[model samples]
Target: MQNEKIINYIKNWLDNYLVKTNLNGFVVGVSGGIDSAVTSTLCAMTKQKVLCVEMPIHQDISQVTRAQQHIAWLKSNYNNVSSVEVDLTPTFDAFKQGLPKTNSKREDLALGNSRARLRMTTLYYLAGLHNYLVVGTGNKVEDFGVGFYTKYGDGGVDLSPIADLMKSEVYSLAQTLNIIDVIQNAEPTDGLFGDSRSDEDQLGASYDELEWAMQYEGNPEELSSRQAEVLKIYKSLNSANQHKMKPIPICSIPSEFK
Candidate 1:
């Protein structure tokens, strides 16, 4: 129940995974928010060589400043850490230049997804070059319950150490670790679009209420109308985005079983 215990548990679990898999290190994308900051710190504390990448795409100064702070915090708080910043604005534009003229909706969505894929691709390249597994920053409330993350974007990673923790729990752990304010208080953002939308705002209910409805509930029919609405949004996103979480199916694997 304690935050320190949870972090220790995660650290030990990661140590075991690294030993079994024989990975030399990890690479994580830090977004200047509490989740990424805390996740990176944990990795650094585990005696892993961590490469923290800041891939900002047309972001404002505030976001960039927080990112620098994250890097500084990582240096002062822990060793065996290196930082890199690559602006993705040009990359996003180049990809868009080749696309056919469609409605703004398609263009925008495509552009956003492309940025995510680009970040993952770059991370993978770095992973291969440096022999480090990509450490994901998604938390339990984001990935499991409602599927709030971008497919192939933030969701593409080899492992997510904090995937099982709720948002509140993540913050609690950050406090225990004494993660700085720039990280702990940074307004949560996807850092893709110009405006940042809170994850819960996109979802129908608050994390606490949603967790309660999902964790301890009877039949859906027995729930109140409000509860049903929350369940509907959660299930809708989950079903629609389920494909993103799974690997591409190999349709060419011979038809013997069928």
Candidate 2:
């Protein structure tokens, strides 16, 4: 399908969703990545209220700059677009200070996830005030293949517009939408670590490799060594993060108890 057709399809889908939900519009948490840029742009194309919020907690300067530029571009192109920057550094610091100090090795990962959850809270708070839905920016590989997103953190959203698109497809859409080059060319990152760690750095395999693994139906014995390793990594992550992909499990009581 043509990129423009896909763009219009997503815009129409967003419009229909807004009509059904009777919500005001969309509020996207812009992270200076291609996914967010494309997602926010698609929301903007619907000509509805789009609040692109940049919630940064000790974020790298490049990421922050690209987010600002993308938001500026959106506002300039679409009058319905608006933006806000919420510095959550102090809030995160306070939250950390309140918690008991821990020397566990998992603390780093825990704190990284804490950042995502904090941003999720901020997005929902804005969404509540404006009666807008929180638009998620996760792509197919992260959302369903390897499940690389943080549970209830980046994973928390009222709606996800691009979860069906692969990372490469997202890049294609970004190019079609004329997303700012700084963002389009920048490496994909969750930005939860408060540093310059790329998504590949965290996942050990690139999105292309993960996408290949996600759709691979060939025999494992026929695969190359690197492909086998990538498949292993993908499966490990997908299995470990099934809790994020699946619905919340509900334990049912025996009928005799009632």
Question: What overall lDDT goes with each candidate model?
Answer: 0.80, 0.93
Off by over 4 Å in 2: none
Q: Looking at model 2, report the run of 10 residues with the lowest lDDT sum.
A: 145-154
What's model 2's lDDT at 158?
91
What is the C-alpha local distance difference test score of candidate 2?
0.93
Residue lDDT tens for model 2, 196-235: 9999998999989999999999999999999999999999
Q: lDDT for model 1, on a 0 to 1 scale?
A: 0.80
Give per-residue CA lDDT, model 1, range 1-258, as digits (tens): 688788899998777777788978889887778788888988888887899998888776787788788888888877889988878788877887877878775666667677888889888888898988899998887788767677877888888999888888888898898888877876566676645665555565777766665575578878888888887776777688777666787778667876
lDDT score at residue 177, model 2, on the 0-100 scale: 94
